[model samples]
Target: MRRLLEGVVPGELLLHYLSLLARGRLSVEEAPGLLDGAGNIDALIREGMAYCHGDDHSMLVAASPDLVLQRALARMAGHLAAEHQRLLDGQERLRAIQAPTDATAGGAMDQLVQILTDGGKIAELTLTLAGSAQRDWLILGARMAADASDATSTSANCRALYESRCVASAGERESVEAVIRAGGMVRLAPRVGMSMRLADEAIALLPLSERNPSGALLIQSSVIVGALREYFELLWERATPYGVPDVEEGPLPPIQMKILRLLVQGLSDTVVAERVGVSVTTVGRHVTAIREALGVQHRFALGVVAVQQGLVE
Candidate 1:
């Protein structure tokens, strides 16, 4: 041990001891034990002296356990300071590179549209809603919300404007009803502040940051809106009419199921007739029969009820 300390105890040995200290091998009271023993004291003294080489000069002069701990902390602080400074410098450089390119113009809406059209990034957020009916409103509101959402997206796809249409037809509403009845969530805020328009759908909602409203950042390319539309149809199907009585779930036959499936898939009576190998008049007869069976006022309602009843599988 004496011979090991004669020339200089290596940095590896000092690092090993530091690692032990870091790992709780030496408790606070046990630090004094490190200074005890015949050859141990000399070994430590020699190791302390050997710290003089390169950048370890300050560590060698640090006397006492506190002083040694402070030196080690100072080295750590210096390393962290360098890393922090590098991050700051890189951030500053990126800002300098980007600042000149971001030129947004016009009113809030126009500027928003310009920014989106000119290449703005889309932000996605998860929003919580109020109630099931409000959930209905929110679904309706997304059509209204589409324009506002589009203006927020960067490099907003032109098709996004068309895609933004909130197509919550009676058929779609049925889908929403189904989802809600199935224990899926749907909600909306009764009071919306800002108005949004994307083609046929329009939504007005208070700014999300201020209050619980209908507005949110929408991504047209993303399936969320489409999925929401499908969900709306589900709910619309199962939801009782707002002013009307709750209708009973009536029985639908397998033939009605086949007819409803074709209708829901956007097939016209003539096309359905061709597909079913029946005449158009025969298809009409089946449609009338299905509508009567479902007790719906219209063919659209018939489609909705059929879907809700699982007639289309």
Candidate 2:
């Protein structure tokens, strides 16, 4: 031990320690104290232990080449399994979110049409109309609403298809009348300021800046839709179902329609006559014809009727 690290340790003593180390009779950590810190034989033994023998560096510094390879393969297996699970979970979530939203709905009109067309899984629909409601849209709403319960198919499509009800804002009377004529329950809400159209499953929240009423956010979340349904029911409960009043009628001549358009544009009879290429008296006659046709008695009522019926822009 004294001569081992002193640079003169005997080969026999070195072999004895080496044999002991190989037989597990000595540990590398324990062997450091058996030397005097010098000697080629001791240094050789330490070098062989540090570099060649798997127990020193391989077992202590890190795993051996073969064991390291096995561990790497195991980790790869675990990582692949985890990734497969994550992918499956993601796919399931995607399917859940996509299923309900896409198969059932689209834009406001599309949703309305789909619901009205299906008619099953739905009971009653309450529709709100804007003053400038498009004739085509109004017709679609009314006709579809009526057909939902036609009693012709006998498919039991609707469990209780109540009368198609509508809440129309002022200046929407004509469209309201169209719906009413199709057997809808119509209520004229005079002071009700127009917002986007509201229905049972979907509601349109249109930007006020957009002129197109269909330009809207179609909300479909069940909580929001259910709340809207409840509120509309409240309004429907209090609303009075109105019918058109009876009065003497006159046919609306094409010239009378032109005169009415001109009148609404802040134009006088003379201006209307010039625009229509007719005399002022002729324009006045057209205006009178419009008044009689509309069931109104005077010029102001004619304008009112024009607005109510969506005759102007």
Local accuracy of candidate 2 as per-residue lDDT tens digits, 1-313: 2232223333544454444445443344544444333353355444332222454532212113344334445666888999999999998897577656543233233233232333321112322322212221111122232222221122111111123334344534444543333323334333323332343243433222224322234454667655655645555555444553433322343455567888998888788888988656446544654564477887877777888877666
TM-score of every candidate relative to the true structure: 0.26, 0.26
Compared with the true structure, the alpha-carbon lDDT of candidate 1 equals 0.40
lDDT of 1 by residue, 145-179 (tens): 22233222211111111111222476545543332
The candidate maximizing lDDT is 2
Screening candidate 2 with a backbone cut-off below 3 angstroms (N, C-alpha, C), the clashing residue pairs are: 5-38
Query: Candidate 1: lDDT of 95?
Result: 57
What shift in Å separates residue 75 of candidate 1 from its native position after superposition?
A: 2.2
Give each model's whole-structure lDDT.
Answer: 0.40, 0.43
List candidate 2 segments past 4 Å from native.
1-172, 202-214, 244-313
